[model samples]
Target: MKIYDAPFIRAADRYTIEQGISSADLMERAARACSDQILKEHPDIQQVLVICGTGNNGGDGLCIARHFLELSMPVKVLIHGHRESGTEDFSHHLRRFESAGGICESYSGRLPDIPQDTIVIDALFGTGINRPVEGTAATLIEQLNESGKTILSVDMPSGLPANGIPEGTVIHAHHTYSFQWPKPAFFLPENAGYTGSWSILDIGLRADFPGHEHAWGEWVDSSFVLPFLKPRKTFSHKGNYGHVMLLAGSKDMPGAANLCSFACIRAGAGRVTLADDGREETRDEIMHLHRNKLVPALESGQYNVFAAGPGLGRTPSAHTLLKQCLESFRHPVLLDADALNLLADDPSLTMLLPAGSVLTPHPGEFRRLAGDTSGSLEMLTLQQQLSARWQVTIVLKRAYTCITTPDGKIYINGSGNPGMATAGSGDVLTGIIAAWMAQGLSPTDAAIAGTYLHGLAGDLAMKEQGGLNIIAGDIIDHYNSAIKILRA
Candidate 1:
């Protein structure tokens, strides 16, 4: 699941073509893959409205139209855009369709008066779009979106950029089938409106070529994140999986500490110690040797993998606990929630953080610490500044959770559905990250793996039950399953 830049996709095609897979054959494979998926899920669909252009993209639409016609499905192919000549594949398919007597309509100005029940196939602008869609193509995509029918987009939703934020007109596809690899824009948050549920269709592009990069950002699928989580040996010792000193929970918020502690234990920390706000109720949940809850208990002879925030209440005492961890904790720390709120209140606390500490904050928590954003550009600028100033990995939790490294590489996680937006969820993530740090994973790997696993767990949970029953406990329960799947 290597996500590549638009250039890499083009380069991949060149490599394939060099390997004797002609452009036409490649187009055939991609189109057939789309047709295969469509027929598998929508056998009853008829009267497909495929809007084709004159490039290789139109070749894909024409190929699909040709396939459907062969299946005895009545498909009306609407060809648009003028070209002196089309690609060899497009010309080949155009002749084949006419020879088969399939209904074909060519239009450059006005779209055909097709039936509203038609399942529209948008292939006018694939991932090759470098500029804003204009003229009839732009208007047609907008009309298709408003048509209230099942719209399928080829490669990518038209007009969405290959990598960063989308710029102009985009076909809001019910489903987008990409060829071989995924483009970066597929994972961006703003594109959520245009790019609906998408799947990458393997078109026989050889993986023998170079793999894709984070140019499109990280996809939190099992294939991408699992390698970072190696198998633990049966002969492994407690010392082998490092001890985690966790500082979370506040007075009544003791449950936050409980969640982080429970999650850390489940996530495979060799030994867990919690330096929580020493409260009566908080002490009740501490399981002595199993869940250490005291400053003295965290005086491990060895270094610590600390996790702070979670159920930590917003109080003066919570502030003291965070400053202590920031100043003294010798190992990498995972900071979240109230701990971040404390840093927001006290600017000086930023200097106290040890290098390599990882901060995980949803957008609100981030704004409070980094200050209000003037716009989207400022939001990204602030995230970059914080990572540089603290010399720590920053996980700005958002629609597509991003993991920013000290050196400034942004890895956007592609796991977890909307079901993960629940209470105490951040606590679970805190524990998961701490466990990874304890297991000797670098802060960068831990953050990336933790976010991906958390989201994958949520996705798996959502599949069993709808996204509504999603809870923090459900994430914990599915954590092992996610790890196991990644291992497999």
Candidate 2:
């Protein structure tokens, strides 16, 4: 999915309003939907405290306050003084709430004293904010954030820019309720502290906005990506799906190749060939390498997919095999583990990479590939640059796995959890992408579908067996189940 910026967010909202849905109706739906989630999560939240500004965001808070009042719940609406008391939807909500006798207070340069346990609702800013927040509103937001209250930000956190990492006093929301499409800020690693546990609420935005040609980033859910997974055909033979070549493992680390091969076979590859150190410590294990570690699985005069660098140790022979892959492979490649480590040391090796090759790197490996960064955002910027320059795909695995492509597309993976941060997980990911690629997905699509599916599989495993003790093979064990759940 494409990452949307502030302009794209504004365009989406305006497009919806122009499509006959009033902005007031949109705000009302967003606020009420947020309340539904809040009420569900906290059954005891009867006295709600809403802090709103003078813009459409404030309109949302007012609408939400009205929604609570309609439900016979006590609500306190605090309005911040700004240059623009909105005239469109804001005016409509302001009048409706006031007529309903909703308790309203204007923040005239003062933070009002309130009960200790009130849930502070932050509706002061949205994704459209362009400048650093200042004045009384800024001070109020900071004070509220530091107040130890369970805060819920309506859209984007106040004082946070929608694209890059936040730098100022941002609302430390316990939970953020975003509407319609997710803003790019919600997914960036740096914003996690500000946007705590975000949930998207349906606010009725038009799905068919103009210039649908423009790409936008999406937060992946199983429902959204299920169609991309091709169902197996009954007539399909082992040879028909495609043979996947795997180059991984080291002297003491046969488990890497084990995990990769299993994932390849499990994900429905026609055949899986494993090549590690010269001696196949085990033969029924599989395949052979030309130079001991450089193995390409070929059948019927054609190679299917290639995956390298799982538990591949940085030995003289391993580097040689990696270099060979750079120069020779015509098919798509999934580069991971020590493969990226080797590439980082040899800048020239990057030139051998074929267009549309996929490189999956954890943050440290990404730092090695892009060099040290000031922070995660800078690392991401460099990742984007490299994707465009090399015309390949880079999957920077993290709390939210990010996939950037040669076409300048970036996708933040929403699947997976803390359990996936274990050893040999990267090998499972390599196998997944390779499996999809062998089955005929383009490198970009393969990475997205593969990463999303890989994470989803981890999630499934965590549910049944739990994450603390989950191993790489367990991911493979649950891979089919995750895909099945998605397809269903």
Candidate 3:
């Protein structure tokens, strides 16, 4: 699904309104969608206290209150501003809700002594908010957060900007039901607290809206990656799938190379050659190579793709090996772990990287490669800048792994669990991406698809091991299951 900023979202809304549906009708659609989801999810909601503002977002809350009221459920509307001063849609919903005998009151400096079970619906602001929230509104937001109530936001959390980082006090919603599409801020780690658990509520926006063509980013889900997978030919041989050369693992960290090689094989690499010190246990299917023979192997041109860095240490020998790989390999290489660290140590090595190379850097590695930034948003900007300038695909691995390509397209992965944070997980990711690249996927497609599959595998592992017990090998073990789901 394509993600849009506030302006694009507003434009889509206006285009929908211009397509014959009145703005009030659209607001009703949004309200009904959110109301249905809330009621379905929380069937035992004892009471609802909608904190409404003087805008269309408030109108959505008013309509939602009316739904609960019509069902004979206890509900109340606390308006931050006067009804007469509200927007046209807000006034329309307010009058209708009042006609239905809805209890409406002005929010004073203090919160009401309502039942603890009441769900506070935040409709004080929406995506159009550009300035910092202040005054009584800020106080109300803070009080709501401190009230220990289950706060549900409409469209957006009151003070959080739809596109960038929040500047002032924002409502800390336990759940947010956004209309049409997810806001860009929803995917950022910085706003995860404010948008506890968010879902997009489609309000009948035009499917063919032109504004969607210029989306800021995309939500990478199954549908977005399904097309990238190709069915295997019945007559194909092992060579048809492509061979992968993995230059990973140090004498002390052989587990990294083992984990990476296993993941590469499991992710469908026909052949995997691991270049290590040869002190670790070797799998029957994997070919082992000593560090001394690595230079000659690259010159053979037998491997389709190469992945370096994982357990590679930052020693001078490791540095020479990385430089050799960069100088010898003509195909796109995947650099991760200490390989990225080496590049950080010698900035000039980045210039030696082959075009279309893939760099999987966790936050610390990314900071070292691209320099530190203020926050995730600034880091994201830097990620894009580096990808464009270097002509490489930078996979910034985190809770929501962001894959930024050379063309400036950003893909936010939506399939990972916190359990995937274990050590060796990133090595597993590097292996998967390299495997995909070896199988004839373009560097961009390989990175995107590999990221989605890696996260999906982690999610599958989480199902069996639970979040706390999951380890990196668990992710590798579930690669087949993840691929099956995508193929299915």
Candidate 4:
């Protein structure tokens, strides 16, 4: 799914309204969806206190009030603005709700002493809010936040901008029901606290908007990635799948190479040549090379792709070898772990980064490649900045793996779980991406698909193993099953 900014969302709404659809009707539909979700998720709620503003968002709140009242459920409405101060549609809904015997009180800068378990519906402000909320509105939000009630925000949390970092006080919603598409703010870690679990509530707006070509970003789910998958031919042999050269591991950390090579074959790579120092426990299906022979072997090898630097220790020799590969590799390549660390050490190495190369760096690794940043927004900005500058795809690994392309488009992975935080996970991701690249995927597509599939595998593994018990190997073990789902 494509993520839209505040302007595009407003334009979509305007486009729908211009297509002979009444604004009041659209608001009613949006509110009805919100009410349905609330009733479904919190079936045993004691009461609902709808806090409404004076705009279309408030109209949505008023419609929700009427909906709950019609169901004979306990509901109360509070208006932050006078009847004459609200939007034309808001006034329409307010009168209709009142005609249905619903009562509403004006905001008096103090929260009413309601029941303890009342669910507060925050419609004080929505996506149009562009400044810090102040005066009575700010006080109301602050009080509701501290009231120990579950606050559900409409469209967006009050005071949180649809894009960019929020500057001032914002409503801390326990859940946010967005209309049409998700806001860019919902994906950032800085705003995660305010947008506590969020879901897009499709309002079924008219699809007549012009220039649907531009996208803010993508939400990488199975459906979005399914089209990129290539099916295997019945007569295809091992050579058709492509050979992957895995360059990982140091004298001390052989497990990294083992994990990367294991994942490479598991991800459907036809041939995986594991080049590392330790070679005591080698599988018959896997090829091995001593670390000392890597340079000559890379020069002569006809590998389709090279997955480098999982456990390649940050030694001078490792750095020199990485620089050589970056400059010499004709096929696509990926750098991770220590390779990223080496890039941070030598800024000049960035100039040698091959075009269409992939870099999988965790937050700590990304900070080394980029600079130290405060939060996800800064990190994202820097990630895009570096990606465009280097002309390479940067995969910043985290709970939500963010893939920034050289053209500056960002894709956020919607899969994966906390179980992926264990050791050797990044190595597995590096291998998976390289395996996809070897199979003839573009650098950006491979990064996006690999990140999503890796996360999906982890999510599936977490279901059986639980988050606490899941290991990196579990992710590798489930790669085929995850691929089957994506293919289907």
Candidate 5:
């Protein structure tokens, strides 16, 4: 799904109106979607408290209250601002709700008595908010938060800005129901507290709306990636898939190399070669070359892409080997773990990186390479800038791993779970990306596809292994299943 800016949402609404769909009709569609989801998810609740403001979002809340009343559900509706100072659609909905016998109290700057344990429906503000929330509304939000009640926000949290970090007190919703698309705030980690799990409800927004094609950021989903998958030929053989070289593992962390090599094979690499210090156990399928023989191995044209840095213990020779790969290897290269640390120690080592290489760095590694990031938004900006500056694709690993291309485009992955956060996970990712690169994917496509597929494998594994018990190897084990799903 394409992630668009706040203005595009407004433009979409306007375009919908221009296409002869009444604004009131659109409002009803949005309200019904939210109401249906709420009813389905919280059927056992005895009462609901709908907190609204004097805007279109409040209008949505009013419509929801009417629907609940129709369903014979007990609900309390409260409008926090002037009842007369809202959009025409809001006024119309307010009158319709009142006519339907939905009692609503109007509050200017003070909140009315809220019933205990009632699910709170927050509609105080939406994506149009540009400043911090303060005064009576902020006080109301604080009280609502302290109420220990499940809060569901309409469109967005009441106080979150569409683009910037939340400025002040915000409604901490258990779930945010966005109409048509998610705001940029929903994806930033700093705002995760305010914008809990968000889901987009399609309200018949036109996909071919003017200017829709200009969106730069995208949410990587199955539809977005299925086109990138290259089907194998019936006559294909092992050599047809291309070879991958992985430089990983050390005396103490040999398992990292093992996990990476195993993942490469599972990710469909034709052949995988590991160049290490010969301290780790090797799989029969992966050819091992001693660290001293890596130069000759490269000269043999046996590898199409090179990946380094997982579990490579810090040493002078490790740095030298990484430097050699960066300077000598012309094919796509992947750098992770200690390779990132080496570059952090000597920033100039980044200069030796071939254009279109890939770097997989978690937050800590990213901080070492790009300085401190105060929040996810700051981290994202740094990711975009550095990827563009270095002419390399950087996969900044997190809950929603973001892949930034050399041209500065960002793709936020929508897969994986907390269980996949265990040891050697990033190494598995490094291998998956290298395998894709070896199979003729560009560094950018490899990073995008590899990150998505890796996370997806983890998600599939988490279904049976559960998040807490899931390890990196579980993700590797589910690679075939993930590919099966993707191929489906």
Candidate 6:
């Protein structure tokens, strides 16, 4: 799914309104969908309190309240502004709701004593909000948050910017039912608290409306990644998959190398070679080359892809190895863990990076690579800047991993959970990306697909292991299952 900002959404709404269907009809469609979903999800909702503003969003709430009234459920509307001052659609819905015997009350300075079981619908603001919420609006939002009741927001949480970071008081909604498409702000980690769990309510807008505008980024899901996954042929041999050379593992942190190697093999790499300093208890299937042999191996051109860092320490020798790898490998390499740390330590090594190289950095590592920022939005800007400057793909690892390509396209992975936050998980990601690159995927496709599959594997693991004790190895264990689901 393509992510659109406020302007694009508004344009799409206007275009939708221009396409024969009246704005009121669109509002009714959106309201009916939301009300139906709410009724289905919360069948026991005895009372609903819709806090409405003086805009179209408020109109949606009014229509929803009327639907509830028709069903013989007790519903009330608390209008923040006077009904006469509302928009044409808002006034229309308000009059219609009132005619249907719906009870409406003005929002005074104080909130009424809301029952714990009553569902509160927040329709005070929508995606068009561009300024900080203040005065009575701010107070109402704060009070609603404090009410300890389930709050469902219409279109957007009041005071939350559609495209940028929240500046002031925003409604902390339990869930937000977005109309047409999801707002770009919903994907940002900074806005996660305000958005909670959001779902897009399709209002039957014109499909071609977004084609006229540019999308901020793509929401990476199964459908988005299905095309990138190539089916295996019956006649293909092991060599057809491609060989991956992994320069990982140190004496004390040997588990990183093992985890990465296993994950690479599991992700469908035909061959995996590990360059390490004679670590004990190495896997039998993995070919090993001494640390000194890495330079010669890079010159040999036998490997299709290269991945470094994992357990590689930040020692002088490690720096030398990284420097040598950068100087020798002309192809795109997957760098993570200490490799990224080494680059942050010595800024000049970044220049040596091959074009289209993939850098997977967790927040701490990203802060080191790109200068520290105030929040996720600024960090995203810096991520994009660094990607353009270095001409590499930067996978900023997080709960929602963001992949920014050199060409300025962003892809956000919507998979994985908190369970994948364990140690060595990034190493597993590095292995997966390396495996994809080795299998003939371009640096960009490999990064996006690998991130998606890595997260999906973690999700699968979470389903079985219940996400509490899920380790990095567990993600690797479910790699094939993830692949099967994607392939199917």
Ranking by TM-score: 3, 6, 5, 4, 2, 1
Off by over 4 Å in 5: 108-113
State the C-alpha lDDT per candidate: 0.78, 0.80, 0.90, 0.86, 0.87, 0.90
TM-score of each: 0.88, 0.92, 0.98, 0.96, 0.96, 0.98
Query: If ranked by lDDT, best first, what sequence of candidates would result?
Result: 3, 6, 5, 4, 2, 1
Regarding TM-score, does 2 or 4 come out ahead? 4
Give the least accurate 10-residue stretch of model 4, judged by summed lDDT: 206-215
| Tens-place lDDT digits, model 6, residues 327-347 | 998999899999999999999
TM-score of 2: 0.92
The segments of candidate 3 whose C-alpha lies over 4 angstroms from its true place after superposition are none
Q: What is the lDDT of residue 446 in candidate 3?
A: 94
The global Cα lDDT (0 to 1) of model 2 is 0.80
Off by over 4 Å in 2: 1-3, 82-88, 108-110, 278-302, 467-469
* Candidate 5 backbone clash number: 1
The root-mean-square deviation over C-alpha atoms between each candidate and the true structure, in angstroms, is 3.3, 2.6, 1.1, 1.7, 1.6, 1.2
lDDT by residue (252-277, candidate 3, tens digit) is: 88889889999998888889998877
Tens-digit lDDT string for candidate 4 (1-488): 88888888888889998987899999999999999999999999889999999998899999999999999989999889776988999999999999999999998989889898899999988899899888888888889899999999999998999987788889999999999888889878778889999998989875457744566888899998898787788999988777887778877888888888888887877889887765535457778877677667667767878888888888998888788776766556788999889989998988877788899998888988887988888889999998898899999888678889999898989999877888999898888888888787898998998899999998889887764758899999998889887787
Give candidate 6 regions above 4 Å deviation: 210-213
TM value for model 6: 0.98
For residues 146-166, what per-residue lDDT tens digits would candidate 5 score against the true structure?
878899999999999877698
- The CA lDDT at 369 in model 4 is 80
> Candidate 1 regions off by >4 Å?
83-89, 108-110, 206-216, 228-232, 235-237, 280-300, 313-317, 371-389, 465-467, 484-488
Cα RMSD for predicted model 4: 1.7
TM-score of 4: 0.96
